[model samples]
Target chain A: MRHIRITAVVIKELIQLKRDPRSLVMIAMIPLIVMLLFGVGYGGGTGKISIAVVNLDKGSLSWTVLDSIMKTPSVYVKAYANSIEEGRELVKDGTVSATVVIPEGFTEELMKGASTQVLVIVDESITTISSTIRNAMLAVTYKFQQELVRSVGGSSVELIYSSVYGPKVTNLEAFTPLVIGIVLQLVPTSLISIAICKEKERGTFEQLIMSPISRYDIIFGKLLAFFIATIADMLITLMVAVWIFDVSVRGPLIDAMVVSTLFLLGSLGLGMLISVLSRNQLQANQAAIFIFIPALLFSGALMPIDMLSPSARILANLTPMYYFVSAFRDIMIKGFGLWQITWEVFALSVYMVLMMVTAPLVLRLRVD
Target chain B: MEYAIEISGLTKKFGDFVAVDNLDLRVRVGEIFGFLGPNGAGKTTTIRMMCGLMRQSKGTIRIYGYSIPEERSELIKITGYMAQRFSLYEDLSVYENMEFFGKLYGLNGEGLHKRIRELLEFLDLEDVKDRLAGRLSGGMKQRLALGVALIHRPKLLVLDEPTAGVDPPIRRAFWEYLRGLNKEGTTILVTTHYMDEAENCDRIGLMNKGRLIAEGTPKELKRRIFGGDLVEVVLQGRIQGDVIKGFLNVGDLKYKDGETVLRLVLKDASKELPSLLKRLDSMGLKVQSAEPINVTLEEVFIELVTKSEARVRGEAY
Candidate 1:
């Protein structure tokens, strides 16, 4: 409640934070490291589905089918096996995700107007990728049949693909907002979560509370110090996503900064609440991770909330991460300004207010 | 007399265990008051309640004229506390620690800086001003803790076992500083288990089993426990022990040296010994010598605690 007392606490905390090497490294380098990990994991374009092709038919039509399979953007023809056994060996040895075998009489059957099947052998261990490989193969065969019909003089209609942002939205660009939201959410929360508990464990809180300072002074002072220390990492996280990974941001940079500043405050508030409730540093650390994992999973950062069950959707709607990610995506992808994201702004404000108010209420001025 | 701290009916209960029970204590202004007890006598609990660090389950505490827990904010400004443990920020330098605490008490700018310098010099901590608190030796760390507690120049300084674990020389020197502060008109309430240290207190309160069993000056407590000062008297001739027992000022009498020497408990040995010698001379008994025997606080403490325990046992039956 007193400005002098709060300023004293803020100055003391800043000096302590500056002198602590471990915390300094966490604040300076964690965002960059997390962003790099996100870039490496998601920047490679959903990982091309690699498959091996075994051509048994000597006819020109089988070569055309093989070429069509190799030409599909999502599919990669990693190896040309001499026999079906070798192709199956490639899939079995994990060299490729799946194996496609063209039978010996594929062109003859198609010329006689009889339907014949192409055998596809796949390793099912890589569940998601193998399923995607199956779908890619099905599209390849369908396109080859259409080409045969068109060459025989049948009329055809074409389909075109376009994105709302542009005709070509790269994988990294589309995922930038999600990665930024995660970095802003997780790094700052984990960094500041142990602030109060560390004081309690070290016996310093006994001395701290002896001063004529209120709970509001302690909570807000720590909140302000950690915000100053962590805001650098937030900016670096955004810069890494935009400049290093070449992810485009369609809206003004100020809009992103404003949204990020609000989200960072909310994240710091959540960490402060955790710090207040916990008895020690280890408890606070575990609580931060326990709360963050669920937020990351159900917040529509990794997947859409629509794909989740009803209860999970409710959870997604409850977390601040969901709103931040949604708001960030709108600004980055759609060039939306701060005024346009009304729901997200209101939700984040509510989350921030709730955390800042509840932390001091639960904080005990007494050691016991 | 004006009291710096007045506590009545103070009780602290953790579930069914009562750490401090129905305690009443008053520390006068501008005097060193010592709270003495054995381990688990609830000395620290009582001090914590007085400092508003812990709320009493059933009692009222007024430090100076302000009520506790209601006017705790105002009370904190004029009261400084040093815990039993070294509770200052160990990572901070000595000067920084003092500055931080001073500012919290609303002393700032030129005034805060001046007070810090004054305390550093007064506590002989100026040389180690730049050293981290955790890196200081045992004596220096205790000194810094004391320095921070004095940063706001509080009217009342409350210390809970400030000299719990230190060398004899440092403890003695630490008390010397306390004596100096007491001279400056600061009301000090200190708790310690060391009987020898309690001898320095202007008044001592002996607590045992959550109760103040005895309270007085060290000399008064010794007299109270042993029924007054013990004195030895020697006569040139044999004396009648029963006759001496009937003396007006004698509390108890015993003969040694084949009835020639007598050990007598007097109500006031200094006042009565001279008169007794004169009276014996008038009765045709030549007095050899008379002197008051010395009693240590350690002996007084043991005697008082044992008697209280015996009384408690007797009551239980």
Candidate 2:
């Protein structure tokens, strides 16, 4: 392709985009909005959970157990039930996440130096909150057992815990790479496809095809324009994720930028393919959303890829966002270098090449 | 004679429907050729094929000796096309649109700027050169689209309904510009449904139902439809139709505005009109006026279309 012709198209597209205030605002603000919403909403494990406590044992030892449960940051004792039936009623009514039952004679058994158990009844419908409450209950019971063993003149065994990659990974920090992948893929893909389809809808595509510029020039010109704009968008998102959310980029920044650029190219290529297949802007927008939803679902962003079914794993391998999210997590969270993500880079490059080649071939210059 | 565009037996089909059926056309260099048709007459399809933007289902099209779909790259360089719609980028300024098209045509730097400036001045669009194309009025948008098409100074300009919705004065001005361009050796092939605009063409082809029904100059087409000159006579008193018919080799007779009008087919009208007038004087019917009337292209187009449709119905029956 001739450079001058490509430059002309690029400049024209940029001017058009600059004039369109709605699209510009959407491109710049979507990432910020998505990052802030997801980062702050799910950032720390649902901050405060309400649970019912049934203290049937009106003794000092049971109160100590209640104090331990209350001291945990995530759990809040919302309601006091006199019996286990009342606590179960509170759980059934969805008034709280779970119910803690301290049975009668629990303090008498503990004072006699006999083993006792605290019955924790939880609602399993809200799985995440239920699991979090369960874990907190286990920790509180373990602390009471250690205290009882220490006061009774028996040796206490301690267990130590450590994280392999992140010692203090918060929810926001863990999902930062996912946010980056989603922002890079969704925004550029939708914007670029809509831009090309708008030309087709407005009847300007016929004029472009009639000109001497080749199809490659048009595609590459559009890709270049969106790439620059989306890269700037990615940088802003990166800053927000790092500074505001306290998510660190542990690997080389250049490596992250390069991999992100590759992912952007792949996403833009998918957008071009959609533009080629769709007849108008509405169709293009619909098709982009159609692809984007599936890609996000299977990209290992929502759930781990290994946990998926065998066929689902194969399908996840096909989506470019999967490789992008994996590579981004590896570089950003796992502190891996470029060599560690060679496979993901290769996969994304292949996807980029395939989509870029197929788009122009499928694109029709004539109305037919 | 060098033909700017030559097509023989061009056909385009969408599944079972034939859009352009075995069409043959030839347009000479430096001539304004009007392609007149009603809606769905395959005018746009034929123009697209000629421009090499679309491939013909069958047959051959050669624009300036460059065969379509084979030499499409070469063909696009020499042909400028304005589609039936407003095809310029709406969000770009008028000058930006021109400059972009100029670069696409391989003109750049100072040369591109100069050509854009000259075109803006020539089309009288200098005042709105900085305005977005979407913000321009209908006439201004048409002018800008025309300017973009003319940016590369192509040898052949193919315009599809270039003035479909413009006002009459703007349409006239656009035609004047086309005439100036044709005078400077630029061949133009334009399509329109407006019969009045087709009258300005050096030659025209009327298409209907994917077929070329008629092709000629405006005068030639009128002659083909009416077969002779139309003569209107204002008599001192109204004359009966049978008496007028018995006079001579008149084609059709009708009474209009309380006068006798005769459609006459003669070997030569200038030679025969005077004697016809003398006979009218001798018959004791004073002739207030006798004159040959020029037929409008609109009448010819309607007559030809009605005749073709009748023929098709006759064939079906």
Candidate 3:
């Protein structure tokens, strides 16, 4: 491929992108907006979970437990129902996520050094909120048990959990790499595919095909342009993630950028393949979104791939984003070097090569 | 004897439908050749085959002695094709569009800049060089497309409906530019449905139903269609059809607007017209005007297409 021809295509595409301010703004701002939404809104666990409390005990110990649950940052006590029935109604009507009922136990049981259980009724329809409620209750009970043991002059044994990497990582920090993967996959893929399909729709594709430029030049030139755009988006998003959200990249920035560039190549290649397969911009947009959703879901971004079924795990291996998310986490969160994550890097490279090589072959020069 | 574009037995088929069939054509160097046909006449298909944009089903095409589909790269360097639509990047500035195409043709450095500047001035787009192509008027867009096609100074230019929707004055200006280019030894092969525009070509090939029905100069085609020139005579009073028929090879006679008009076919109108006038004077008929009416390209095209359709139907039966 001639460099001049490729340069021409690149320059022309850049000019077009500059003229369309709306798309340019979308490319630059979407990552920041999505990151802010995820980081601030859903970060460090969803805040203000609502639950109902029923205090049937006449003693003050039950009030102490209720106050402890209410003081927790993530839990919100909606009301103190007079009866267990009213608490259950609150949970059933979705007024609250769960109902914490203290049984009619006399304070004498705890005073005599006997253990009593708290009946926690919960709605199981919304799994995420229910799980959060369960964790909150366990935390409050654990604290109360420690205090009870200490007040009686008895030593308590505690189980402590630690992690090899990011021991104190927040939910936002853990989600940074996945957010990068999602942005790279969705934004650049759809943008490049739409750009290509728009050319075909507007009839400029015929002129390009008839020119002296080879097919590789056209595809590569376009891919390079969008790849640069993706890099800019990644930089802006990473800055926001690191400074604003307090997420750190423990590894070298160069390694992170390299892995990210490879991932971008893979995504851009997928976009080109979709562009070649689609007949118009609408079809291209649909195909890009279709691929993006599955990629995000199976990349272990939202959930661990190990939690997936065996067949789903195998399917996850086929997506470039899966390896990208894994490698991104390893490099950015775990501070692993390129040599340490060689297998993931190799997988991403292979995906990129396969997509880039096959895209042009599938591209039809004739409009019909 | 040198041909800029040569094709023999060129054929294209989409599944079972044949778009172009058993076509043979040769465009000479430095001459303007017009490809005339109605819609779906396979003109665009043949042009695309010549440009190597489509692979032919069966046959050979050589542009400037470069075999197409095999040496397409070499052919593309020497040939510039403007599609039927305004195919330039609409979002780019006019100068940017020209520069992009120029670079694709392997032009760069100061040379590319100079060529773009020259084209912008030549096409009267200098005033709007920085304006986006999508914002230009219809005539300006057509002119810019032509400018892009000529940026590389290719030896052969193939234009498909270069002025399809332009106003008349702009269309005439475009033809003038084409004529100027042809004078400077550039070969042009253009496809158009406009009959008046086709009359400007040095030679034209009329096509219908995927076949070339006729090929000649405008005058030659007119003579071939009617076997002579048509002479229209206006008389003050009605004349008997039989008396007008007494003249040899009188084509058609009709009364219109309170005057009797007579059409006659004469191989040599300059010699036969005077004799007919003398005969009319002796017959005591007052003549208002007498002149040889020029048969338009539209008339010739319609006649050729209708005759070909009838022949096909006759063969079918």
Instruction: State each model's CA lDDT, in order.
Output: 0.87, 0.86, 0.87
Off by over 4 Å in 1: A40-47, A56-58, A79-93, B233-262, B280-289
Predicted candidate 2 versus true structure: per-residue lDDT over A1-368, tens digit per residue: 29999898889888888888977986889998998898779775557899989988867899889999989988999999999999999999999889999988888987887877788888899777888998898889889888877777788787789878858777787788778888888888888887667888888888999999888898888888888778877787888887887788899878988888888888888998888888788898888888888888998978899999999999999888899889988988888988998999999899988988998887767765
TM-score on alpha carbons, each prediction: 0.94, 0.92, 0.89
Q: List the pairs of residues colliding in candidate 2.
A: none
DockQ of candidate 3 against the true complex: 0.62
> Model 3 compared with the native: what TM-score?
0.89
Error of 1 at B312 (Å): 1.5
| Candidate 3 C-alpha lDDT tens digits along A1-368 | 29998888888777778778877877888998988898887566556888888888888788779879978987899888989899999988889888998888746689888878898998899777788888989899998888778877788887688778846767787788888888888888888887668888899988887778777888999888777667888787788888888888899888988898898888889889899888899999899998888888899877789999999999899878899989988988889989999999999999999989998888766656
Residues A115-163, model 1: lDDT tens digits: 8889899899867777788778878877887888888766666556667
Residue pairs clashing, model 3: none
Worst 10 residues of 2 chain B by lDDT: B260-269
Model 3 spans with C-alpha error above 4 angstroms: A43-48, A58-76, A106-116, A139-158, B232-247, B252-263, B268-291
Show the colliding residue pairs in model 1. none
Instruction: Select the stronger candidate by DockQ from 2 and 3.
Output: 2
lDDT accuracy of residue A60 in candidate 2: 88
Best by DockQ: 2
Q: How many clashing pairs per prediction, in order?
A: 0, 0, 0
